[model samples]
Target: MDLNDLHGIGAGWWSRILAGFHRDAGLEPTLLELGLILAVALAVSVPRASWRYFGLFVTMVHELGHAFAALTTGRLVKGIHLRFDQSGAMMSRGSGRAGAAWTGFWGYPVPAVVGCILVLAAFSGWSSLALSVSALLLLATLLFIRNAQGAVIAVGLALASSLLVWFAPAALLGHLTLALGIGLLVGSVRDWLNLLGVHTRRRHQLANSDAHILARRTGVPSALWLAGFAAVITACWVHAGMAVAAVAGFPA
Candidate 1:
């Protein structure tokens, strides 16, 4: 056959092959993607050597929680700092007593609530919605990120999430959504447990903890504040489970 005839034959064959692959690819998550989701879930299930990364993620969420609370309650957010020592801080101004109390109150439980929402959205097949919301929150938090490291981390996360929302395939997006949702939920729970452990075992080191700050402002005991945080997180976990179960059966 001539070169033109050969070229047409090759192009037509390639197009048919691509169409076949697309037809079989489907939109649902595949077995390999599900395995990946399982792997991510297990990676963040508990506090261990790999927990440093989880801690950083939780710290970002925690600080962003405070920042959002500050802004929502009529406070002027100045900046946020995230450290490698599994700690973070948010600076704000113009917040009166009520605003301060709220900002302090939200720092602990907000991560759990956010995790719950993510889990619900992921399980309900709202992958795009989940990624979009996550990217927006990270972008909003980016405005208050003060330090170089914090800015890098926030910008990186926001960009990755934006790319996923805009370009990831449906199955890949769903898989990643579920993985991230599970990781956040597990990390938040582990953080809460760790907070309780620290507050109980190292009572003298409670000076900078959110519970201590809340206690100082509200004239309540730090232990009570810690207990309240635990209660709210527990409730959120339960409700998150229920929501996920309603959509995709109980999570194994």
Candidate 2:
């Protein structure tokens, strides 16, 4: 094998990836453009065909949120299990019920938090940096993947992210990031709706839900936990909306 075939990424590509770290021109979306982006985001997130693949990325992010939160509390993370069906679990050893509650809380809200960060980065001329950093972080999660499917998803996502960063021009990266950020935000809402359906329609699946788990552990009703997740996700949407609103004048 040619030495240039290093992990499918040549040595020169390192500079291309590293070079994205610097800020370039920021693109502020017009009201009409913001509406269009939202529609495109919804197209991917709301459609089942697109969601079947894209939702896996959201699930990966969800599980990583649990692991990151556990680490934040000094918990020892064991491993992560992810499936093609978009289900996942993160194992960790930790003390303190509060810590568990806190960790549990993050799984639902983190995608929205990340979405807001991406949107803000797009508006601030850091879209390339955001994409590169995020892809590297996704690659880092490979260390914690315990199952075959999880390994595949992690590697697949990292490669996709890397390719996007490597090939997308700086001028267009902001629009792409904005669309991605919006997709994540929309996906978060869709997942939340599915969880809500689990509680309201499919009570049998409560065992697999974060809110129910929180309620069982904290003695806080599941409704309240769900509310907490909604609150955070809503706040992220509001913040991102305001950022768009600042630049977007009256819609034509």
Candidate 3:
């Protein structure tokens, strides 16, 4: 079936799913949207090939989080590397202890924060704004994508987001924002869970994990960093859920 026909089939269900996301004229996600967000997150978390490909978007956001944190903390970011395997990394140089620590700490939590914000925007009827911000972030990250695979992915996403921000219809844009948010949430949760596994075992490839870097820089244990990362992600989940519920006219 064509795009329109596909959209038509799910239109009724999408309407119900997003029923309470909008109220009045403001742009905060309501209870219905929040529930939808979690539901979508869970769906994307399933181990399927389609979901796995979508996970690439999540990995990009996760790596860009590190890149942005590095730049924000006065570090010079050399480049970002996204691999075919869906693992990614940010290369940067910073001598400041705080900068190093902050960059490393941000890697795990940033995706959830970004996703939550986008979900809020989507419910707020700010699809244009949501897409614009996302587009800008991806474009800015393009300057730092060093590897060929990363460059192609970054450029492709940047172009797609830009086009959507400028041309997509309101309803389609909203769905896209929701999808992005859901993917990010799923990816963040999955990544943290993987780290938790490594933490429990007390062994992981140090070079491949953020917690190890944080531990090395801050003289803290990797397990502690992993715990803190988990806590931050949990906080994001709670915040998004409560905000959605409160706005949906549910009693907070």
Best by lDDT: 2
Better of 1 and 2 by TM-score: 2
RMSD (CA, Å), candidate 2 to true, equals 1.9
RMSD of 3: 7.8
Candidate 1 lDDT over 1-252, as tens digits, reads: 999999997575444323322221212445565567768876875647777666677788888888888989889889999877778889989747888988888877877877777666666556566666676677787878889888877887776666665556665665676677667777777777777877878777787788878888889888888888888888887886676555444465
The TM-score values for the models, in the order shown, are 0.78, 0.94, 0.79
Give the TM-score (vs. native) of candidate 3: 0.79
- Candidate 3 residue 45 Cα shift, in angstroms, is 4.2
The Cα local distance difference test for each model comes to: 0.73, 0.88, 0.74
- For candidate 2, the per-residue lDDT at 112 reads 90
Question: Which candidate would rank higher by TM-score, 2 or 3?
Answer: 2
How far residue 158's Cα lies from its native spot in candidate 3, in Å, is 1.8
> Which residue runs does candidate 2 get wrong by more than 4 Å?
7-10
lDDT of 2 by residue, 67-134 (tens): 99999999999999999999999999989998999889999888898889989999999988998888
**Backbone clashes under 3 angstroms, per model:** 0, 0, 4
**Model 3 lDDT, residue 2, Cα:** 100
The top-ranked prediction according to TM-score is 2
Query: Which residue runs does candidate 3 get wrong by more than 4 Å?
Result: 1-42, 201-204
